[model samples]
Target: MDLILRCLIFSLLHQSLYSKPYNIDGLLENGTGAIESLAKPLQDISTKDYSWAKGNQTCSQLLKDCKEFLDLLPSSSSWMLKPVLALGFLQVGCLTEQEPFFLDLIKDKNARTLFNIMAEQTNNSIHPTTTNSHKSQPDIQKHDLLRFNLESLSIDAQSISHHMHCSEIQQEQQDVLLKGSILRSHSSLQHAMDHCDRVGPVCAGVTSDTLGQFKSVARNGGYIIPHVGSKLWLHHCTAGLLRRRSTDPECHSEKELRIHNVMQWIPVVSGYYNAGSAIYYATQGCTAQAEDRAIDASIDLGYDALFTATGGVSGAVSAGVGMAVKPPLRDGVKSAINYFKAQWSG
Candidate 1:
């Protein structure tokens, strides 16, 4: 009798997993879930007209507000805050690393299913709709932009990090590095979640603690990028790291130069993109491309300065060779680029 009852209960539970359809109650928890805070983009994210809704909020500001909201909430209702708190770590880490905060939205089981649903709605062949159809639209274009600003960052960045993400690498040492990278990503996310579960909806006093955690995560994530250059990290390790500042001015001033370059390029590149897009009445975003171009331009301009400083020894030959070589090199880098591009954008 006991065995039969147990078997019956197990059978019913198994069936329920497949039989139950996606329900709002599962994700929203009858308005108790805080996934809304993370996902609340302007209405019609598929279109371009939506203004400042909750989803369009910057991750830094959104996090500050989320923390405040959690602080004010009642203890009994704290479960609702689980989504943001767990997501906050991923958001901050990814954000500082300059990756997308939006990807953090679907990390929760409920939100993951919600994301799948949102993604499915935009499907054309299966659930095709007219241009004005709201039913087919996803509600987060910021999600789209940030979604494009993936952890790999660019084709160059992807090339460096590919070993860490690739399943096909057979070398034991690289496999270790890959494991470390994966572990950092998962561990950081998990640690935040567990901490939040213990702390509750309101992590009233941990502002410094949370920021520190994010900064550390954003800094390296333990992937072993030599000299902190995402481009050269994989391809040139020993010589790049060990080379004297005298011999290689590129490694010497690379960090400061890159930051300076990016700062200078952001406005110019973005303005260029905005102007062209406006002229064409194009709605598809140019921000991501503008950013990549800005980085590339910055590197070029920085090298021009560097070569001038080095009296054209490092400047002309290196820059000239770079100008000659970059197109082909970038074309070669496209394999890793395409993989992540397809994986994220698909």
Candidate 2:
């Protein structure tokens, strides 16, 4: 028994000493290879006037391949694979029609480094230097000297945001809905600003302005309004107003009324309309200045007045009627809104 134990210990020690350090390099190389393979196809789709069907098919395939590559990666090295995963998702988002899954990725440090690398690569590809033509590069050059910064990352993110078929308003709405806290809404906004700092000023300005508007709405009693359905409905309405205000600060109340009508029926459809409107006015670009002015105007006029002018009375009556018939729903709405108010104020 002693002899057998000694042999087992010796064998285990030898294996431990000789085993490979996690092959991060190999994993990164494979990831880059996957990215490069999809890049050309993505480039073609962007530059060419292809039909939506054709482009969507190509995008779907790329997404599949990306998923396959990710699935094959060793589960133990998932932390190391975040950047690669971020890059793959970004590429797919640039080509696909749906909203991109990039918000969480943008929050990751490793993913940001990968974004910087891609941006640098893109910059070099766009403007190649003539002096480096004579050098013979080694197969495995060290990128330890490569500096990753926010400037390139911001540019890359902005470019991706533009291609993803959603407006800044829609993006901001999604950001709030996903990450915003009904309670601790202030902290949520702060977290968003922290994220924006990593992403750069373009995002910071927009995110700040949008969240500021949300705060303004909360401060002004917009959130506690009875019969508004839910905070989500209120958020959707605010986004529509903000998007319209991004262009015409003095946009007619008729549009606002239409939105209120839609919300009264199918609150979700209003969200879709707002998203579509955002795409339609995507070129207008929701600047911080525009948003600030809009907020000021909305506040000066008062949200209650705006809602009242845009058919709030009828909607309130309808909600009252519904509440009268369904005591549970009425209680639920009261409890929910009260809880929301407590969180908002707290």
Candidate 3:
């Protein structure tokens, strides 16, 4: 009788997973589950918009604000926080890397064409009315401009990182270092390319090439290539963690330290995606490209790491209860299979 009852309950639950009006009441009982639940509403909003919305009251800000809401509740195990935190960190990391790249792409006419297509589609989805249609047009354009602004900022950002080597800085500079005559020569090509490419990979390639050209433009235009030169100088000054004179001539040690401090918070800013956990487990929200990417990547990475680190926490916990348990070797093999499937599907 007990066997039959257990089978029936499991079947009902499994069926409910695919049924309509999926509920979160079950998942919300757990911390990680609850955090995931909360992230659902704003999963589709752009990180740039979310950062801006903290001031502009956009959906992104609404999502970021979930941190405070989570804090208000009772504390939970670090296990729950790991996935949440991981998702957050990954989001910020991707954004940090891609933001500047996107800016460079915008400088190319080929890349701009791609950006315009993506930007317009993203904008139209947000505000769906007559006046909003016109007003939101600029919003899309602004998204493209953000890439440029971020790239310039990235140059300054790198300058302040004292840990980077001169060789690294020079390599980075080469990527963005635009020289005289070259900028003028490439400018038209970039604009033309930005408009020309429509396909994803071709468009992406155009954007990357265009940014390289812009680097030359910025460098030759006498722009201050911040961290590249600054970091190299800092390394020259403070060889070790030795506290040097505050008056060290070659480096802005204090400024670099401050910038690094700010960079540390990028993960926190990105953690808003964890709300997708609730959406996924609860079936409450629609899956989006960004949100789904955030979840699947973390799940794929986190589950494997956790299984290894905890020596299979679930199996260990199940051992005492006499549940049929897969050995670590078998479990690992199964996990590997699932990881590839999830990665490819996502």
Candidate 4:
């Protein structure tokens, strides 16, 4: 990797390594939205921003499935969806180029190193068949890393299904072990799972737990969230996305190819909207700063959407970022204000 890409990867990984997962299921308003119809599609495909919470689920059914989705996801398929979005989000290149992208990453061993770090985080105990956590293995390839993460995710998901709640102490031990695993040394975690602890206090006396805590639990249990290195992937893919098809420029139409390639990113955009809105709801009643942060989250998410739709770094940046971010940012601010006001009055 060149210095720019290396620095970008390290910066993103370090900044985002310990960030929280956003639980979209918890963002509903009294079971509103058509969640069931949406849920079926989201199972195989990622979602879009405008339709983030626009589910056809009635309040009653939304209450049922949203709760269930949050309670315990037995399948790792849901957990793996977010990473799929990440891959899609970073697809500045054609889909066919993905093999070489992974290949190039393997050449430098970064792919192996990154996955090994996740493998270190891999833990199991839910299903008898899924005990393997991908740890302590030798001579792993880049492709194996994500597959191992998926397996590990399956184990964690099954544990949730079985009600194997990992106490903070045990989670802490895992964190310490992961810390000492010699991955990246220089450090300060700006946000930890613990940092959001106070988010639960917002519901003191009225609710059993803070919205943030519940959402975080749902996130951890279900495994639906983004992680580091997507931006680098985005950067890498940008060239292919902007350039005409080299495979068979004459035979295969560029428009069709581009459409196929960009579709991968659309669902990820929905993922961002869903997750960001969840956080907005989670932190809305906490504080003004928290509320402001939620708005910021949506704006950040908008950038991801712009990347896929617009194509190329310059195109994404030059186009109206304000226009891109405005809708969600506005909605977030409105919701935050409305939520805290209702809480105080109640």
Which predicted model would earn the best TM-score?
2
lDDT of 4 by residue, 1-346 (tens): 4446544643453233221222222223323332331232111221223221222323344323333432332221222222322233233222222454333322322223222222222211121122333322111111111111221232222332233222221111110001001111111222323332323211111001111211122222121112122101000000112111124333232332232223212322333323222222221221222223223333333322222211211111121221122122333334544554464345
lDDT digits (tens) for residues 6-54 of candidate 3: 4574444322221111122334257576445334322232343223112
The 10-residue segment of model 2 with minimum total lDDT is: 139-148
C-alpha RMSD by candidate, in order: 26.3, 26.7, 23.5, 24.4
Q: Give the whole-model CA lDDT for all candidates, comma-separated.
A: 0.25, 0.27, 0.26, 0.25
Residue 68 lDDT in candidate 3: 37
Give candidate 1's TM-score: 0.17
What does the lDDT read for residue 104 in candidate 2?
A: 45
Model 1, 79-144: lDDT tens per residue? 212322333233223122123444443344443432333222222112111243231111121112
What is the Å distance of residue 164 in model 4 from its true position? Answer: 29
Off by over 4 Å in 3: 1-159, 166-214, 217-346
Runs off by more than 4 Å, candidate 4 = 1-81, 84-90, 94-203, 207-293, 297-346
lDDT of 2 by residue, 64-178 (tens): 5544544433322232233334443343343332345444433444344333433333222221112323211110010000000011111132343233222222122221111
Error of 1 at 49 (Å): 5.4
Error of 2 at 77 (Å): 6.9
Clashes of each: 2, 0, 31, 12
Superpose all Cα atoms of candidate 4 onto the true structure and report the RMSD in Å to 1 decimal.
24.4
